[model samples]
Target: MADYPILAVVGHPNKGKSSVVSALTQNDQVHISPLSGTTRVAQHFSLKLDGETVFELVDTPGFQRAAKCLAWLRVEELPADQRPARVAEFVEQFRSSGQFFDEVELLKPIVAGAGIIYVVDGSLPYSPEYETEMEILRWTGRPRLALINPIGGDAYVAQWQQALNQYFSLVKQFDPLHASFDQHLQLLRSFGELDSRPGRIFDQAIEQLEQYRRQKLEQAARILVENLYRLLTYQQSSSRLEQAAREQLPELLPAEISRFNQHLNWLERDGQQQLEALFLYHRLESDLARLEVRQSELMDESQWTLWGLEKKQLVLVSAAAGATLGLLADAGLGGSSLFAGAIGGGVLGGVSGWLGLDWFKQQLPAWLQFSAEQHLLGPVKDPNFAFVILGRALSHARAMLARSHADRERLTIHQAGDHFMQSLEMKVQIRLLKQCKQLVRQGPQGQAAEQLRAWIYQQLTA
Candidate 1:
């Protein structure tokens, strides 16, 4: 809601205007191609100063004397009603041209309102044309600061400052790329001065900017923590089945699921490191607890049990069923092929049994674990039901693995991790919703909880 102060960069062509804007905003908003007159129109960007949204930078196109002359002609010749259209046409024509003369004709907006940032190359002697441009800019009567953009050599620094002093109120030599945060702050503070009097408005603005920046950092840190929790939780849940089942399977049995978990972990760690490197606090412990609580409430007792060894056995059985179906996925079998298929099929059958075990463990209580195991590995069991259940789980696992891989390749590891965490957060919210619904059915606390749950769900899900 805070209104940011606008700082406009204006100067002759090829004077590092885009570079200065890029440095100030820490974004590549203004295209910085080697060709002169690249910036054809004003471009705006916002950045936090101090803890507040109190600063903005506007990159204006390079000044061109010839373009100004043509524009002036159009303005004079066109009727008052047609002047706007003519002016637009003339400006467009100028933008298309390769050549432009340094002049103040293009600096009307900054002169009228915004703070002025005038950049001049310090490697060459101050030119008369630049002096003329400064004189034109001065007519707009805005607070102006001249920045000498050092290039090539330092020999012309003294001459540049002397020439700059003839027209500008203050001059400073600044390298945009190498400027430190303190130095940048000091420059903004200097701009806060107007008519030899200090501007108190920017003091509060800077403080606010700093606060906003800190908040952004904190938010990023929170995001990283959320990602880590998702990675850890998902792995813990899925691993119970994978590990136990894998050991019983053939050696070449694809370790894709395990590898996917590892990849997810790497992404979370990378995101954490990125936040830490920026000096942002890593609040992993607190975030982890929040996620765990939320997860506990979201997943049912049965689902929670899916994270254990009993559940893993079911996943193993499911994998076996999946392998058999996958083999049938490619028909035509010779004697050797059938023999290989049988061996592969047995390994897959064992995996299917493992998956079934996992599924049953989640739904059944601990007291029933032994009974379920007996039923699964027992002498009399429904082979058809086992096949169906294992096949479904295996299919889901394959799809999940593919999606995880695609996500990894499409997004940076950190971004993917963030996404995974967000998904977990949503799942947690959904669980909370169910809890609220159950409570509502019981009356009293349930009604209020349901309302609150609905509000939060709408906000988050929307």
Candidate 2:
């Protein structure tokens, strides 16, 4: 057995092949739609099984019967030198021919060396065409397993199973819609049996597969939790600071807070993009598109109408808000002129929002609201104790900004400047620490979360 087992997922047209691929990979890499013939080409995605790279899934387009005359033509005309290209042409012809909904010519990868994961619709009655396809699959001489993908009722499962057993060495019924970690493990185990070259190799492969599954699952969980914490904590902290500024420095708070919030928003969005790349293995462009879709869903129709935000508009708004807020905070608007806090907050917020924090904010306060008297309102409808603390902090920031402007001499401000700066830094650090600690507590017991906590602490200290 090779170190990396290539598993090719193949089945009749509209038999949930892509769904199985998506489920096993835990990735939305392949686009799945209700329309048949979505997958026109084979796609490859690797999965870590056990502690080693032992599993690679190749999602091939759905198989369909070719017309008798067309099949004969393909058999005679498919030249050895141009087989790959000719096969692709034939597949395209069949797809456009309207004689069948799927073209089976894409199964060339499986015929080469990969093990076959033959999927079939369990809901429909077993058809002779499927049997013909299975017989054709057997001709490839690849070790194959049958996966009965249920798209409808289970009433026809017995007949489906009977048909599958005739061709496949192993048969398993799986609902791709609700596939679990254990089910995937079982599927891999069946593939493991295909390799007859006995030794510790099979055992090693199985061990590696199990370890990989566990590790991947843990990684996914960590990513989800980290993103959730980052979004929530960043939003709460930034919102509180903004609200405080609005109340304390009535003259300058609104503009400054707005600027700071915008910067923070950008930081959060950027963080989100990084997170998606790390976990989902998405390119920056695709991740950005996904973020936009999520943001659109989060923004209600009324909000969209008010902002006049198209997809590009939202991205611009988020980016502008982040840059403006970051610059203002760095320049010192409220009191302490700490460039570090301003930059850090802005980056964090912007990245988080970009990644997926738009969804998080929907659960928080509305961006805009009106009172019963038709007066525009900010984040908080009522001023509370937290609001007061936030207000004082903002007032201090404004005064510091004014003093910095008034006194051109840097060192001349001296002790007064030092005190305000130190106090502000301490407050920001404390707030961030508390948030990070809470996030760690929410995570699963693992080295990753511990490492993340340490990283957060180091960032704060730095």
Candidate 3:
């Protein structure tokens, strides 16, 4: 790993040095706080790909007595070529002393071979007080980059940039809380430009990081598709059935429906957890609308538009699906010679599609079935149910993808206007509809589910 880049993140207290490390490594476990002296010692973290460390970052304590340390270093008349050795002597002298503990810890990595990343709050006005720390770091003679973190706003960014340009070879504005993946890659690219020693290695690291992200997205798609299948085809059966249970089953529908909904929620959450873990977000929390089937009217029109398809598009798709099912059933019964069954099925399907949630309201009891020997809750009958499940999964997955590891707040998944299903071409929509029907009948193990997973991966990449 000596051939790979090692960057020492040095800064004043509470200026988002740890936040930069968190975002760069994509590790949520990194400690962060607004209070001073949060990181008290130097710790090394590595970004590894396939069990190989790509690069390393040293999260070191902020400069506690920079002015005093610099004053100590200047007591001896040293030439410019020997100044780094003087800084090294200061670290050796104060390694065990309690006076410049923070300064020694931060300078240890820079005295070694680590490149410097000096962080400062771009949101705050620049002052001469911070120059003490900057001047101390400049004495180390390490390749340096200055990250002006706009912790609040970019109002003071240019002010910081003007000052940092004098000490650092590169000055850039980086916001850890909201940086996209591309920004992260670009930042790493800039790290490569800091020094020529590991330029090719840093480029390889960026490529590996992109590949790892794509693989995680593929895994996320699989998790989401599997969850959609499970939710759509889920059934809750009762073993407490008696001979006369059919008569009482209708009364027990509410409790059974509640249990079914609970299980659905659990399944959805389980998939979400898998996705979060895949992206290395162990402590992620989300504020999302509930994913469940309502007993009153399936789903509201507004929700359908948000999570499934628009009213007009859903109606047309559902009507076509119904007519196909009707024609298939007619052919299976005897032959397609019976135009009556096909025509009736098309009209009923079209009307049901037009009715939307109202049709689901009327057919709720049908979904809750009871026979002489069996009592079951569901394999959701409505075609629109498929879109609802799929839409919610994609929403949660996309939210996780967009989130930065440096964020401490709960992820809020808003209901967006354009749904993935709604934007698809009609043929693609029809193919998805067909695959969803196959899922209900054949479970999530066959070629149909594979096709759905492939489509989901395509959407994720898009």
Name the lDDT value of residue 129 in candidate 3: 95
Question: 338-397, model 1: which lDDT tens digit per residue?
Answer: 223222434333323222222344443111133312321221121222222222222222
Lowest lDDT 10-residue stretch of candidate 3: 334-343
lDDT of 1 at 174: 80
lDDT of 2 at 359: 21
lDDT (10s digit) by residue, model 2, range 1-462: 356677788877788887787776655566666788778778887655433465677887776454452454357654455544554454456655555434443455664567789888888898777666675566556788889887886778899898889898898898776655567777777777875644544466557756664454345335434543443434222333344432443344345345544544454455444544433434334434454343332212332222222333333332333343342233222221121222234433322222222222233213222223222222221111121222222222222222211111221112233332124343353343333344444643545455544543332223
lDDT of every predicted structure (CA atoms)? 0.47, 0.49, 0.74
- Give candidate 3's root-mean-square deviation (CA, Å): 5.7
**Candidate 1 structure lDDT:** 0.47
lDDT score at residue 196, model 3, on the 0-100 scale? 69
Q: Can you write out model 3's per-residue Cα lDDT over 1-462, one digit (the tens) per residue?
A: 386778999999999999999888888878888888989999888777777777788988888888889899999888889999999999899899877999989999889889999999988999999999998888899989999999989999999999999999899999999998999899889988777683487788888889877877777877887888887877778665333345664465555555665676777777788788788888774433233232122323345565646666665776566576652342232222222222244333322232222213234344445455566666655666687678777777777778888888877765665667788788777677788888777877888888888888887767
Candidate 3: the clashing residue pairs are none
Candidate 1 segments whose C-alpha is farther than 4 A from its true place: 1-4, 48-53, 66-105, 151-155, 195-199, 228-254, 269-462
**RMSD of candidate 2 to the true fold?**
18.4
Per-residue lDDT value at 316 in model 3: 72
The predicted structure with the larger lDDT, 1 or 2, is: 2
Which model, 1 or 2, shows the larger TM-score? 2
TM-score of every candidate: 0.48, 0.50, 0.85
